[model samples]
Target: MNIKNTTSIFVDCHVFDSGFQGTRTYIQGLYSELIIKRDLHFFLVSSNPDNLASIFGNHSNVTYLKYKYENKYLRLLIDIPQIIKKHKIDFAHFQYTVSPFKRCRYIVTTHDILFINFPEYFSFFSKIINTFLYKQSAKWSEIRLTVSEFSKQKIHQHFGFSNYEITPNAIDNVFFEDYDKVLIKNEVAQKFSLKKYIIYVSRWEPRKNHQMVLKAFLDLELYKEYELLFLGNDTLSNPQYNEIFSQVDSEIKKKIFTLKNTDFNTMLLLLRGADASVYPSMAEGFGIPPLESVAAKIPTICSDKTAMSDFSFFEDYYFDPHNQIDFNDKLQKILKENLGTDFKIMAQKIKEKYSWKKSVEIVYRLIKQNQ
Candidate 1:
């Protein structure tokens, strides 16, 4: 096999330290696949190199670089450039956006321009800083890669550029693994005190549209038949959660429960055992939870905007993200319909359609072309 420009590729693995779930999953999947490729050398840089190294090490072509800084912005502006030049890297792939200055040709993954589109979701300081960095990376990177076609279009609309490629996110086969349904279901029910539950599995935040999900559940009176299981961090520190919680009556509040920092297998079991899975996010880059739910062979309802549409094929599975009436009707329909076979077929197609191996291959080829 002929490989073009056998130059070392530097990947910023700082995402591990940031505690962002979706970004970490994307980078970890790509990092795992890329390490196994034969024709390229990789420099994995992070403040927590030991953690990443334990996963991506044991390969002759992969080198681990560490930087000591507690602050993300300081590490990016100061530490990353110094490390890139010190290693003499030819191409650097930033898992998020790029540093303002560059020592080499670089590629950036603009996951989504959510801050630009929904500025209200972020604080004023965060919005100002992130918008500037995102625009710069989109404007100046050697190659811009986004997770979904929807994001590519949004980036173009926001940044006035269309020179980017869509690399798309994929589900790991771990989600598709066979498990003892009876045993796992019993365990999940006991742990969460759940009985006939419908699940929502994402970080609780405004952009996730948790308020709308709660409102719809309350309006439809689904709480009478099924409890709502929230399967992620409660994020109590976020003022949004407090505001939403204050509006709920104590009776309605008792029906909702949150389980934070769940183990991966347990989370999968919850999805598998759910009567139905609902993902009502207002925006997303690739919408992993809906895909995970579908992969678990659960009847899945998703917001009909952004990349959630790519995960669920049936029209009945989607509802307007902004409208509670649309969500309630769809949620009712999914529960009322016999859709198990339909969900299984869609899961098989989604599994085939999104592959980490294929996504990494595209990234590899792009890196070679730029090199």
Candidate 2:
């Protein structure tokens, strides 16, 4: 490795606090691979530098910088540029659609343009903020990257930038760590009162299409055979919560579970032990949990919409997200299928397609090419 062309790469790690699953995984996976490269230096910027350090450990090539302010605008506009210049960064990776300053040469990862396609899901203020920042970020970025072909097309259609790259999201190989099913099942049963369960891993938000998923699961009578686990934080503020719960029978409600802030290891155990995984999201830049489930060797059923179609097993596995009948049918197929062994084979193939090692190499080459 030639040290002559080594560049200082600044990564906006603030997405760590956003609690958005896809963005968090995208950054962590890439960073984990990048940190091992001897030819580059990293400056990780986050609100919680200690926590970031704790996750990545003390890499000699990595430096962690804490952003003290809680206000996103102030931190991005003033603090971020100052930090970049202070460290004399050659390039930076903004993990999301926007970067605070345009003075430095940097790459921006625009996860998706969901706001443009699904305006009803976003507030007016959020739409405004994202619209402005997304356009500016697209214009300024040296290389724009997205998580899927669906997201890349969305960005091109909405932002009119055609030169972007598709850097698909991938699971941490940690999910593939082997576990003893009998012991893990016994432990999970005691901890979460587990039953024969199908897992749905995503935030409890409307865009995740939780209502449709719950309806489809109940309509198919799948709840009688298997518990429906909704993994993520409570969405008490979401109106759909009351509407969906109101329809649930008191007895059936016991079979529906929601676990928020679950530890990663425990979540992996849950996935491993699950009978199957269900993801009927309305839209996505790229769906991670479905792929994660497949990687965990848990049979998965996903919506046919958006980036879920990109999954290698999707042709046989996807259903119409908006149609409860189609969802119920897909759920039934997943319940009856004994394709776990085949999916495990597909999982290994899928794993090859989405290595963080490959993704970081693209980023490194992009940085080098631009220089």
Candidate 3:
């Protein structure tokens, strides 16, 4: 388990971005921790050179390798083997579900098996590629890591891989640190002109069940004084998202604000200042935003389904994702309650359970053990 002399570990860094969502945040946090701890020399192979540089710039131990491919199959079949051989990588880790080359020892983080469960949401070609790649990756990987017990079970049931490890995804420690709450609240309120607001941070996809949130918000007469902020980009890449955005009622749309391309600090300020954070998704691998809200001492409402229930910090705060009436009733109760005591207690508990340093330490241990 000697990791000190390991030459380098190549990472599939396609998800490295600055938007502060789940996958990008996971990779960025892990990369930052590894660089600081000197766990191993790291190299990122990705199609987006700009994102690689944006995320890893000025880190001495990290290097970026440009990977160009017209499709995932081409990357899997052609480019990856060349990069591994040329760089002499001791091990390779894929952030996504699939890995391209299998020559060296490999570890993969399976965030969730969404594609396997919801094939209709993906194209026929994409579904095929994802299914094949996941099965192959599970069969070949020296170690497998998943974010939650729910996801671990799903992976085992679907791919029949029994040797996988669990490393729960966590929030950055910086989010849990003390900040000038009054100042941040004032600044965010002024910037967004937000008087009273509830926040939902996720991509506007069908599975996210944003329409349910929207419907619940519209049903609440109490929400007339408060704005519903949807803080994530809405790329037209998902047809369902496009149709939902297009068909939203004019009155509801007026009360709704969609903010795209927000940075981590701004998002932290917003979450910290909000009255409550709501996420009623139909599915999730491991819901990170609600975890972040818990860390930030914001009252959070999330679906009682999938890995969302596995987050131990917010045990009493889940609602049915399909029951808009129930959601609205809960929202009303949250709006009326004094959340300070409960928020502080939950925030402290979350700080203990979910930390990037702990996550990286587990990952490093797993890698060293396999090495």
Which ranges of candidate 3 are over 4 A from the true structure?
1-5, 17-20, 37-39, 47-57, 69-74, 97-99, 118-126, 235-252
Candidate 1 to truth, TM? 0.88
User: What C-alpha lDDT does candidate 2 achieve relative to the native structure?
Assistant: 0.81
Off by over 4 Å in 2: 1-6, 18-20, 234-237
Residue 4 in candidate 2, Cα distance off native in Å: 11
What clash pairs does model 3 have?
none
Worst 10 residues of 3 by lDDT: 234-243
Candidate 1 on 1-371: residue-level lDDT in tens? 22234577888888665433787788878878887877787888777778787766677778887877758788878888888888787888885578776899988998888777777777788778877888887666887888998888888998887888888788878777776767777887787777678899988677888777677778888888888888877432546556777887898788888777765567777887788899888888888888888888888889988777665575668889888888888888888899978888888888888898988888888887886
Off by over 4 Å in 1: 1-6, 18-20, 53-58, 234-241, 247-252
191 Cα displacement, candidate 1 (Å)? 3.5
Position 85, candidate 1: lDDT: 80
Query: What TM-score fits each model?
Result: 0.88, 0.93, 0.88
Q: Report how far residue 80 has shifted in candidate 3, in Å.
A: 3.2
Q: What are the root-mean-square deviations of the candidates from the true structure over C-alphas?
A: 3.1, 2.4, 3.2
Q: Each prediction's Cα lDDT score?
A: 0.80, 0.81, 0.76
